[model samples]
Target: MVLVEDALLLAASAFIVTSFVGLFRVVRGPTMPDRVIAINVVGSNVVIVIALLAAAVGEPGALDIALVYALLNFLLSVAISKFTVERGGVL
Candidate 1:
């Protein structure tokens, strides 16, 4: 069980580290959609990491927080996409 927990921690850390690579796209993406996708990826990855950490730490509250974060990320992504489409990518 300990080994499994440790593996989960390592996996979560690995996910977070790789998510940083998406930052390049967010910062210097050739187009607006590319940047939006990158940001969405980072947000999803963060939710995964948070859930994993919650499991590793045996904290139900952390999982709740992760769920809320996921919801917010999803809503924000949709809102941004809609705004981009409606405003020709101005906002």
Candidate 2:
């Protein structure tokens, strides 16, 4: 039987892989908005991965780190969107 910790790790791995794939969009996006959205997606995925790893390890402190990361990701996305808008990229 698959243990809970093992399952969480597997899910985290899958998210990490998907996040890497998202990086390709950031690298080759045709527009600044596209790149910004891709970066946000990857950042969100990282937060999820961190949370999952924290759960797997039974570390509550890591959850706090994940929360901080999520807040930072939100701020980054907003900042990037504002910059893109100022630069004439559509929201």
Candidate 3:
């Protein structure tokens, strides 16, 4: 199982790289919506990485937390969208 662990670790590292890229884009974005989109992308990657870590480490309830984080991400996006529309501004 060492090989499998190594592969998973590699996958996790790639995901982290993507997450950081997304974060950088968000920080340097030219528009509010662009930043929001980056945040959403980062949230999704975080969810996937969390789930993978849960599997790799055999951690109980890690998946549950990931799911919760995923749900929160969805809600945040929706709320931001609504607020933007209501305010006639980018969010």
Candidate 4:
């Protein structure tokens, strides 16, 4: 059980690092779609980290929060994509 918790922590750390990389992309992306993709990547990484934390801490509520966060992320991505398209990529 200790090993499992340790592994989850490590995985979460990796995901956080990945999210930082995605953050850089979001900041430096040359195009709107690229920034959107970066945002999705970061959001998914955040969800993964939250799920891992829930497992590591034995918190059921965190899992539920993570699920809700995932849904919001998806919806936000879709909305941004639609807005960008409608705006003719001005975003």
lDDT of each: 0.91, 0.92, 0.89, 0.96
- The number of the candidate with the highest lDDT is 4
Candidate ordering by TM-score (highest first): 4, 2, 1, 3
In model 2, the runs with Cα more than 4 Å from the true position are none
Ranked by lDDT from best down, the candidates are: 4, 2, 1, 3
lDDT string for model 4 (5-87, tens) is 99999999999999999999999999999999999999999999999999999998999899999999999999999999999
Off by over 4 Å in 4: none
Alpha carbon deviation, residue 9, candidate 3 (Å): 1.3
What TM-score does structure 2 among the candidates reach?
0.94
List model 1 lDDT by residue over 1-91, tens digit each: 9998999999999989879988888999988999899999999999999999988988879998999999999998999899899988754
Best by TM-score: 4
Pairs of residues at least 3 apart in sequence or in different chains that clash in candidate 4: none
All candidates: CA RMSD (Å):
2.0, 1.5, 1.6, 1.5
Off by over 4 Å in 3: none
TM-score each candidate.
Answer: 0.92, 0.94, 0.91, 0.96
Q: Distance (Å) between predicted and true CA of 4, model 3?
A: 0.8
